[model samples]
Target: MRFKIGIIFIFLCQIAQAQQSEMTVNQNHYDSEFKANSELISEFENNGKSNAEFRLIAKSNDNGKISVYIQNNTSDTISLSHQDYSIYILQEAMNKNGLWKPIEYWESSDCGNSFGEIKIEPNEIIQTKSTKYSGNFKTKIRFKLSENNKVYYSNSIVGNINPNKLILPNDFSFTWPLAIMENIGKKTPLELQKKVVFLEPNGMEEFNEFFEKSMNKKN
Candidate 1:
């Protein structure tokens, strides 16, 4: 009995060590990839102005991932935002104000300190990491990429908001910001929040109505 128990203990220890070794290998690979992608983004930031033939193509994969493919037509390498975080604006349809208002409140927590970017080699086409859309309205929505205060718009894609459908990791529920809550009918400025949250269509309407009613009573 003693010999059998000792063998079992040794086997368990070996299994634990094997799992730890695998985890270390995976972590190293992730760090390597992250460093590689960051370096590409830096190169573009430094020399992107000299290139003018770059193009941004938006694509939605079957996995509900929105990927922006950047085609570098210049002879030099260039970098651009990965479009995987809150780097792009979610614009609603053309309203009576003739302005495309940003209605997206989703922000990524995975990106810390700086948004992710990737370097595309000369004539190389690279796609960004997957990004999820959270707009609950059934309007024509588009992604807008801005650099140097100039906006670059993507092709419009329309879909209804599915609160049950989780398109992002670690999504939560939170109250709308005062900027959006106060300016219910008006166009709100493009402000990025810290965490991404999903709300049902009716939930948004109910909250907005409550906010408006409370404000009217105060007035």
Candidate 2:
């Protein structure tokens, strides 16, 4: 009896240790790498193309994982979490032959069965998982043709974010034999796959268009 009890205690200890190993990232993981070019900012305003402002809003602490958000200069309240923001991390190619890479995305993994929406007033911020983890931005670079048929890039690009998603449970594991097998290839609630886009002067329209399509599909 004594030996049997010792084996049981050791097995329980292993289970507890395994459960404690799951880790989330630090607050800094939610930072954005979306840097707007000063020249582009100036050129857009000079050309009378500036209509709105785009910025990131994030929150984190030792008690919780970081949450990321986007603030837009608009007039209506927006429901963002439902939209699942997609991010595009932009890479600069030296010879125009460099390939673009995917952005670093983040989002809430644990969601209760209850669902609620946060109302974002105009010019208010809405949340995104992509921003909460870590991010990379992709700008759609545009170049102008001169009269000499030469390509002169004002070195500016327009970028946009798009959304795709999956709905899953928050729990990462179910040690029960059947439970483990049942969840194979399933998505987790924390799995958010939305892209947060940075709009150049001309990207606003496309962003709105993408947003509208996302809503339609959700409905």
Q: On a 0 to 1 TM-score scale, where does candidate 1 land against the true structure?
A: 0.39
In model 2, the worst 10-residue window by lDDT is 143-152
Listed per model in order, the count of residue pairs whose N, CA or C atoms clash below 3 Å is 1, 21
lDDT of 1 by residue, 193-219 (tens): 121122122433454565577577668
Q: Candidate 1: lDDT of 40?
A: 45
- Which regions of candidate 2 are displaced past 4 Å? 1-69, 82-97, 103-110, 113-116, 125-181, 184-219
For candidate 2, the TM-score is 0.27
TM-score of each model, in listed order: 0.39, 0.27
User: What is the C-alpha lDDT profile of model 2 across 54-157, one tens digit per residue?
Assistant: 33433343443433444443566654222122322222212223443222222222334323334456655443332222113333322221111111222333
Best by TM-score: 1
User: Which candidate number would show the highest lDDT if scored against the true structure?
Assistant: 1
Model 1 clashing residue pairs (backbone):
44-79
Q: What C-alpha lDDT do the candidate models reach, one value each? A: 0.44, 0.32
